[model samples]
Target: MSAYMVGYARVSTNQQDLTAQRNQLNTLGVPEERIYTDHGLTGTNRDRPGLNQALAAVRDGDTLVITKLDRLARSLPDARDIIEELTKKNVKLSIGGSIHDPSDPVGRLLFNVLAMVAEFESDLIRARTREGMQVAKAKGRLRGKQPKLSKNQEAHVVSLYRGGQHTTAEIAELFGVARSTVYRIVQRTPTLN
Candidate 1:
């Protein structure tokens, strides 16, 4: 089995460049042949084709490297999940740019601490978003995603649906909404209808 220093790079959007990442890995002595790139793919899924192929190609002693933890996954849970999977396969992993190797005691301690901090930070973000929404709602400013149909529009849609004059798809098209929205309104009591 060929021992490989595999590099995985990712970008969330089509406009983002992978060249910089590739160059960095190449400069670090990771051969271009050993780098797997997923451009325009979110780091939210483990189903990346390039990543999968690279992992499959590696032997137990081979190294899997990524620029950073976030480039590999979106959340701590995701990162932890991937790490556990790789560990089970006896594959070595490295966060090539920012993270220290977690093989040693100190490095392992630091990695766990940092992962906890990341999880805490994510929770803060969610809390802030919820608080902001609450404030906006209190101020009478509309908050969250808008319902597909307005109150008056919903009544009209319900009438048409109840009368059975138009199909769900046709009602959806007429109201510039989804078929599910039509169904929801039509299923309501006549008072709401």
Candidate 2:
């Protein structure tokens, strides 16, 4: 029997365009029945139903087509892991931007180099974000997460707690805050304690 080919496409949000990705595979003559699409889900999620369906449907020695490696995954590690799984299954991965296969020695060398470069880029992004946050804090721009309760509500919650007028759960419910916040208040403030 001939090797079966299936395609997977994804869009970050429901509003994003998946048509281009789908069309790329369609241009390669992939049938509608063999194409799976996932819309409005984060690329970071592993439990993607459409991706799972495509993986499940492909048999040994089958080909899995994606318009781009990034269309299949967000993170480089995620892409590498998915490709590794496919390789172990005797499945062929065809990336539009790639004219090589990592299973071969030369291709393996190139793939590792590219993968390491992508990982380096991601690390730089993380470092830049941390530095940006530190600079923001120095400039007093990093205010942290805003308190769910306003000053008036916090004072009211404290007053009620001090007077023993309400339980922790009740205070949480009344202020629409968390029980942990109530506990933190009662433990930190001498009047509430």
Candidate 3:
């Protein structure tokens, strides 16, 4: 069987673009159609569909191409697990156009170093984000997801629901809200005996 390159790209957030990674993979000689990608998925999450597809596409003697080690995996154990799988399948890993040779001691050491760096970076990002959120919460600037209805609006919804003159769908339509929201409002309100 002939060997070919299978490329994988990933972005941790929806706002991040995959164009640069795709371009890099293309420059590495991977065909456009052979590239797989995941959007809005964290590298810490191992259950990405695009990564799975890319791994499945590779065969013995084939190369799995990634723009960077972090793009393939952000944690050291995850990176090592992926590398082990590729090694078991007799497949090579090409990180930024440099093919990794697991058998070589130097190569293994370098790969480990890169994996540790990726994991460290991921940890730093998470820690900084948590700190920022905590600061925001303390300053009352981190009010999460405001309610869809105001107190008055909720009371009106409950009254309309208790009146039993209108159906849930009709009440939702009148208030320009969902039936589920109406149900929630009614569920929380105390019923009058």
Full candidate order by lDDT, most accurate first: 3, 2, 1
Structure candidate 1, residue pairs in collision: none
Candidate 2 residues lying further than 4 Å off, grouped into runs, are 10-20, 36-53, 71-90, 97-99, 150-153, 164-184
Candidate 2 on 1-193: residue-level lDDT in tens?
7888889998879889888988888887678889998999866677799999988888777878888655667676776787677767777776663444546767656655665665566567779999999999999999998877776777777788888978989989888889999887667666623
Model 3 C-alpha lDDT per residue in residues 42-138, reported as the tens digit of each score: 9999999999999999998999999999999999999999888887888888999999866566777888899999999999999999999999999
TM-score (C-alpha) between model 2 and the true structure: 0.64
Score each candidate by Cα lDDT. Answer: 0.75, 0.77, 0.93
Error of 2 at 169 (Å): 7.8
Using TM-score as the measure, which candidate wins? 3
Q: Order the candidates by TM-score, highest first — what do you get?
A: 3, 2, 1
For model 3 the TM-score comes to 0.83
C-alpha lDDT of residue 105 in model 2: 69
In candidate 2 the C-alpha lDDT for residue 7 amounts to 90
lDDT of 2: 0.77
For model 1, residues 59-85, the per-residue Cα lDDT tens digits are 676777777666776667776776666
Candidate 3, which segments miss by more than 4 Å at Cα?
Answer: 1-3, 13-16, 57-62, 191-193
lDDT of 2 at 13: 90
